[model samples]
Target: MCPLFSNLFEIMIPKLDPTVIYEIVVIVFLACWFIATVLCQFRETKISWFIRYKIDLFNLIPLWTFFAPHPGKRDYHLLFRDKITETDYSEWQEMEITEERTFWSWLWNPEKRDKKILSDVVQSLVSSIPSFREKTGNLNLLMFSTPYIIVLHAVSQCKKRSQNCYRQFMLAESSGYQKETKPALILLSVFHQI
Candidate 1:
């Protein structure tokens, strides 16, 4: 142990052991983190505004604005199928993104960003229907869009057998928050070589 660390702890609390002092420091840190996170919810107040804007160094509070202004009540389903040969097309299978949660998932989730990115790209692709209609003469222009490229890349990365050489993907909307809502077709892509 460094002499400066020991000296500082001794100066802070005279008789306590260094191990007890470390535990105390950790407890205080967690308490402050929890308190600040809760207080950040009331950010319209003066103190909360200060804590959220001025002193939050590590971005400890998450802005939970997933549903604001226009909340998405429908879910977009991406379905793809692989072509084995000229006329032997496979069944359309949905690209299922499961939100698997383990005991420690809140602390370390690798798939969290993937889910968000895919959803955003899908939303953009659905919104690109107008562009697809405008460029009806050339399908290449529709395929070259950013959202289309991203979705194609994601679909091409799916698990496939050795015989699968080409892939096609489509976006469909379904009722996510409300089961009474009707399903609709969004966009269908041409088969592209993998």
Candidate 2:
């Protein structure tokens, strides 16, 4: 070992034998690996407010795929919409989102059942936009589809007045689309182009 490393080790592990040094190195390596793995997992799974904001921002990029509703069993709208659609969660007990897997086979994977639910809800929302427009006409509606408070603040900053729009938007703040009508209209237009 270099004198500098030897000196550092001498101070850090003063009483260490060769066997102890080896064990110490192994333990530190394992600890670093464990911490890195945990951070990776957190980055992958932890959906933070920043991530939600990013999702909302991407939602406005005029990309139809971004609006592509989740094709799963759970309707995210149920928690925010006027009425919840009753669907059998068991139907999605096997649904998985594997890249190589066939659609039919993925429908049986319980691990992905929740994803299926979220997808289905988004699909339903996309489908319902046309119906809403048909009933309400092309009003200057501020619809908030996301369930984030920050998204609401962003919407308030982005949209102009129509107190009615704000009330309607706030009514479903926790669950479904806030300014969903416009987004739905946007989705409809995109869907037609596709």
Candidate 3:
């Protein structure tokens, strides 16, 4: 050891055996690991029970981040819909993902709301739609369908809205088309109101 290090160590722990330092470091590391594991396991149990019961109470607690890291992937989409001249229109809004960015960049950026909160809001909105409720039939189906429908509806709306002239022509050319597209028209109207 350097003279400086030896002098500092001797002053810090006078008359202590050098071997004791290694033992102390190991014990500290193991203790920290055990504590972290216990916290994570406890958090997981709470989260699993909350999800099983479909409880919104989980949001109020907000203890998940203290133990578990946020998920790696974010694949949720936000969708909006509206009807114009008896024709259906839809649009998808881009969602921001901060977790995927570099740690330094994330630290520098302003805080964003949790993705889970956005997902919960979308779930509530989608569940309120009559067609979605009828199609899903239960919580399990709703959970499975929510992401797919949000993405699908968003993409469909973008495609429909992009063809402004074509949409106008189609609407003007056929009164018959409106009858065939009544379900979409109703969905567009309902989602737009929300």
Give RMSD to native, each candidate: 10.3, 17.1, 15.4
**Candidate 3 global CA lDDT score:** 0.43
Cα lDDT computed for each candidate against the true fold: 0.79, 0.38, 0.43
Model 1 stretches with alpha carbons more than 4 Å out: 1-66, 98-111, 135-139
> Once model 1 is optimally superposed onto the true structure by TM-score, how far is the C-alpha of residue 108 displaced, in angstroms?
6.4
True lDDT of residue 70, candidate 1: 64
Give the runs in model 2 whose Cα sits over 4 Å from its true position: 1-108, 139-142, 145-194
Question: Poorest 10 consecutive residues of model 2 by lDDT?
Answer: 185-194
TM-score list, all predictions = 0.54, 0.21, 0.29
> Model 2: per-residue lDDT, tens digit, 25-130?
9999788655544443323445433333454354321222433354232223212111112331111011123223356764665545554544444454456566
lDDT per residue (tens digit) for residues 116-158 in model 3: 5555544455545566567676333442455444544433444
**Could you give me the TM-score of model 1 versus the true structure?**
0.54
Model 1 whole-model lDDT (C-alpha atoms): 0.79
